[model samples]
Target: MSLPHTPLERVTSIKRKLIILIGVAVGATIAVFYVGVKLGAWPGIAGALGGVVALAAVWFLARGLTRPVREMAHAANLITRGDFDVRVSAESRRDEIGALARAFNRMAVELGETDRLRRDLVANVSHELRTPITALQVHLENLVDGVESADPETLQTMLDQTIRLGRLVEQLLDLSRLEAGVVPLDIRSFDVETMLQGAVRESRLVRPGGAIAVRVDPTGLQGVGDAERLHQVIANLVENALRYSPTQSAVEVRATKTHEAVVLEVLDEGPGIAPGDAERVFERFYRSDAARSSEMGGAGLGLAIARWVVDLHGGSIRAEARDPQGCRIVVELPTAIGAA
Candidate 1:
């Protein structure tokens, strides 16, 4: 992408300035001809010829300058009416108009992407919401009709569906809050290892027999950030690891303190994310073909929320294929000052 033209370039662009200049010149020529006719007949004929020539020049210049803008204006109207595919043929020009064309193309691309994501979000959310709600309705109906109810198994299933619905709603709301930037980060310094241990414990609760190994470079891997939010980030990563990994496969948590930052990695022995999906895995409502189990996965919001929290603390999070097997999620955060 070429840099946008500077103010100096805009002023100096002869082609861009000529469109206005042509209109003014045509008007001046006509005014001179009108005055010359009032003065004398010969002067009027000569002035009229000059005015006619100027008018022709203006017509050509107007077509060249205004055609692209007319096309763009029509396309913009279509876009406003919910058409995202309309494109203008102005990118080939090497002037201010070309810059406008490129910007319009970029806007169209972004609007198209946003519209697609919006549709996907609505579909996914509806599907996710309906599943548990349908299950609950069925269970309630059965109980009301006296066809079922005293059994512990049936009750438990309904309870599980309710829990699932609640979890999904909570995650969606949290995601909204984070994205809106209303959730403030209470920054502070604390022991990151302690938070890691807590997250590992939570993951173990999710999968009782799964192993979560922690490997820290230094004794106490201290970090500085909102500890509670960081814990949520860690737990989400660990839960994702457990959900995809085998029953007894080990998930590793590695931590190290660098010169100016604290780095943590969560490694899972599951089918790793595909290269194409690595960048998009953190997108809300996104599911990949590389996913271990499409039906069994969470509402596809965990990684997105985790990323938001990490970013809140001036941190970066990324995922990659683990060596030889599995997937790795790395989180890097800036360390607070003067902490040993």
Candidate 2:
């Protein structure tokens, strides 16, 4: 993460240390000179020279001690100026100061990550909010200008847009609660097939013209999870498929028991997700250019929410391109006892 730029306080700590070192060095030299003069061991001039050498040695030692301090101060200033990349190269002398420097570097790295995530969150939220709001505004303005009458069809379309906006708001609120750890799961054991059937049935009701199909292994795959949330997960995936697949193309939902888990897949004949975008598609407010412009109703939070629900249940979900055409989303969850 990039460090923020801010001015750092000047380092005045070295001044006090320099004063102490100079005073000690001067006092030791004076004492040696006085002793030499009293003992008459050598000429006074020779004793003065020896004292000078001793003071010089003290000065050199003081410089050695303060050099690292000077470097550290410079680094701190760079960091304060939002340069998190700056690092102190002091050796691991097993000293407290060295440890503190290492810890400071780590904290900078974490702060950068936090800042990046915060920016992404805000951008994604804005994009998601704008799409539906813009659509509703345009439609409302047309009606106000008498471009569209209050006919049943026009009124119904406007009502649908309003409902879509409301749903988007609700989904955003739900996602916020889930991310904040405020939503608790009602975990229990249930037949995965039963849940899948219900979700497929509901989706069919909404897109009756779509040729969506469901297939199950019928081996009675069971899982421990919040059934309601799991149902939502299935519905979201299927609905996504419905939105992307061409009219008359089939959206398939399938489930089978793996060795250690139950795998559920929603496959569609729509243009497959680009390999580069497979993972990012699960991110909040991420949509392909085609999907973004399509009339499918969504705020781009469905996949993110589904992933969260699966994660809460100790499961995993991933998307991959299907052979020849389309994309497949696979969800794996631990199988209930006696089902494996």
Among these predictions, the greatest TM-score belongs to 1
Among these predicted structures, which one has the highest lDDT?
Answer: 1
Q: Compute the lDDT of residue 191 as modeled in candidate 2.
A: 84
In the range 4-77, model 2's lDDT, one tens digit per residue, is: 22111121244555566667677777777777777776667646765786778676655445444577789778
Task: Provide backbone clash counts, one per model.
Answer: 0, 4
Inter-residue clash pairs, candidate 1: none
Full-model lDDT for every candidate: 0.82, 0.76
| Every model: Cα RMSD to truth | 5.3, 7.0
Error of 2 at 218 (Å): 4.4
For model 1, residues 90-209, the per-residue Cα lDDT tens digits are 786667777799899999999999999889888989998998999999989999999996599998999989889999999999988998999888788888789899988987787675
Error of 2 at 321 (Å): 1.3
The local lDDT score (0 to 100) that residue 129 gets in candidate 1 is: 96
Q: After the best TM-score superposition of candidate 2, give how far the Cα of residue 313 lies from its true spot, in angstroms.
A: 2.0
